[model samples]
Target: MFSPFDSILAFKTAIYFFLRSLLKGFLRRATGLCELQRLCYANNIGAKRTKGVEKSILLSRCPVLKRINTQLDALAEADELANNWSTVEEAVEATMVAKQINKSIHEAFIQPYRICLVQIYGYRQLIVRLDQIRGIAFDHNNEVHLVLLKNLWKLLCPDTELEGMISKQWTDIGFQGQDPSTDFRGMGLLSLENLVFFATVYTDHARNILSHSLHPIHGYPFAAVGINITHMALSLIKAGYLKTHLYNVESRIYTVEDFHKIYSYLFASFDKLWIRSKPNSVMEFSHIRDKFEAAVVKKLQFEDAVFRWDPYLETI
Candidate 1:
């Protein structure tokens, strides 16, 4: 049924298709192997060429490829056999140049890790400093600290001058005892600093809160409450909870100022909470303090939380 010429043409057509399919498959494998080698080099796996018969077949495609391979091989081994460390120091010069190139590669590799390390180191250093601050005793003889404290008291009570440590104004501000230093036992000088910062920076709001401490049935000890708020702030910092409010990924940590801000916010927030809660008596202080702390912790859990002046307090 078929002519001999037609049979010969069909055989040639089938051979053509077979060669084309083989070539397509070989090209795909070659492309994939090249990609794989590049990936290995990128990940520092080290690149090595195939040897023996495979090496000859691999580089047979283009003359440019063979030349590049020869140059690269020569450069890779140049440091091994060279000893130009005499008067000229040519080998030393070559080594330095290689190191310069290698340094850039090393920096590229370790940059992310270095950033992570700096962040972790900065955080740990902040915590250590916080701990150190909390452990410091309120020095009675430190004239500067004493002057700061006096200024704070004066700012709060411009009309009444607190002459001695055992003044009734001390009780008016809510110290637990005649000497305010006795109450600083738990929080050390840090609590005093918080009080001074709040009193000095936010004078009107501080005075308003001081006035609210005189509420007939629900009066709370203002200074004692401030110290407790400082404790809360420190606890949050130590537990890493304050990072949500105190830090951003790329921002520097302002540990002292941030803590002072928290203290001020606590005072303002507590005053508002106290007015709303309308507690029966001063005996309810612990219950109110706990409720206020819970509220603070809840707000700080939010991703974008920041302790700031209350809108109403700012107006005052």
Candidate 2:
């Protein structure tokens, strides 16, 4: 067993194994490079070349990286999963998933990056669109935005006497100065829209929270914090971090409602967070906001994360 011939053979076998391993790894890297090239060329000749099962797999998975591929496979079955066109909430809908199978396989199955590219484009466009709206300089002459602002004020201050847009009554809801317009400089009409949507759609919850904002000892500026939260959500979406919450939905599924839902989640959750933090005064808002954002980020890291608002107090 200890013969020179046996020892020489063992050494040779070990060397051969190491060389084969290196060769295999090199081949794998080469194959991955080719795949990346195909992905880059996905809209062109690569689309025509990829066919049948391979094509389907590539469409569903996109093969961007090994890790993502593995994660997608484990998270969902390809056939059961909805195509990118379906909304995130709709994708998980059983009826929609069934209908998806009826659509042409060719159309239903396309590279996810195409969807991502569209959403990224749309996101930039939305930013520009909102920015333009913001640039409109809060015309007191305009009936639409001003009317909406008045409606929001009226809804919150039903019993109070009306004093128009310049009233100190505006401060009760958290506007920075006499004019609510000044506070909306950063978010424009978008902030106002979010506030109106929150108050109108969730009237009871909004009223309850407004009362909380008037808490004798501990309170933050309700409308001001709402706008800041909108900025926080926009930052998350722009950075592509919202992808976690929208994972089950299609990549192209950005909407104003989506943003509003985030606002609601932030509003409701921040209330709970604020109460729990038990700050001695409103001056601690920055610290609490940072902590709240950190918590939201933690939740977004989960694969199954969904933005939700669970209002603890009943509508007043």
Candidate 3:
């Protein structure tokens, strides 16, 4: 399947990497610092610095360093929780030993490298936590799940009393049918968690957005669109597209709460965009959703990107 041009290009790429590695080695000996340390010193604190360190670590030939990265990823995949700080400390010490980095001379690299590790592994842990929550299907038989479902209703519609466990009132808040459980199929409890967090934490904003969703002409299914936004957030996180925003904003460990914040922001932003565009009906949701996602992805391509919900900006 390989054409002559393709073979030539592959050979050229290989030679380029080989020469680049040799150059890095020569520079390391001359500067008396590893690639990571040099990068840490060159770049300021934030996404650029952290991303540089991450790249250096991933490209490292050191077995211990590679194993540490593998182990962190494996921990997330297995849904095994561990103390992030302790893990970072062990990884830093192990990486130093593997690279023969002198602690006395390279003490400056410690904090920055540690921060990068925290962000790196913290992201993995966040993915694990999200997957664990998303895996739990909403159960009507479960008391806790029922309580959460009721709580969401109470937060959104305080004056309205539920007619029953399953009723048309559910449709008032955007459920497709009398039974709201079916709407949570793909996203599972993660969707519910995101919705509840937005309503509970940002009551006024959530209400305003809900009001927008009820627009007679442009009305859309509130809960359904929220679940769709949750899916988008999860996709962005898993695809590593959120790293620029996360790295710039969170110096510490990332959590499920952080993810909820992201989802809420997306939901609110989507509401604003929806109103501005003034679609004839809810039928345009798929196109608008894709447009919104593309915009978010574009914003996240910048190293300085940090998304936060501002109450003042929510006025529409």
Question: Which pairs of residues have clashing backbones in candidate 2?
Answer: 88-249
Off by over 4 Å in 3: 1-13, 79-81, 312-316
Report the lDDT of model 2 for residue 289.
91
How many clashing pairs does model 1 include? 0
Query: Which sections of candidate 1 miss by over 4 Å?
Result: 1-120, 310-316
Instruction: Estimate, for each residue in 57-165, the C-alpha lDDT of model 1 and write its tens digit.
Output: 2323435334433433343234211122131233222322432324344334233322222232344456566667678887778887677668867988899878885
TM-score for candidate 2: 0.63
Candidates in order have lDDT scores of 0.62, 0.62, 0.87
- In TM-score terms, candidate 1 sits at 0.61
Compose the digit string of candidate 3's lDDT tens values, residues 194-272.
9999999988888888888898999899999999999999999999988888899888878899999899889998998
- By TM-score, highest first, what's the ranking? 3, 2, 1
lDDT for 9 in candidate 2 is 94
Model 2 has a clash total of: 1
**lDDT of candidate 1 at residue 131, scale 0 to 100:** 68
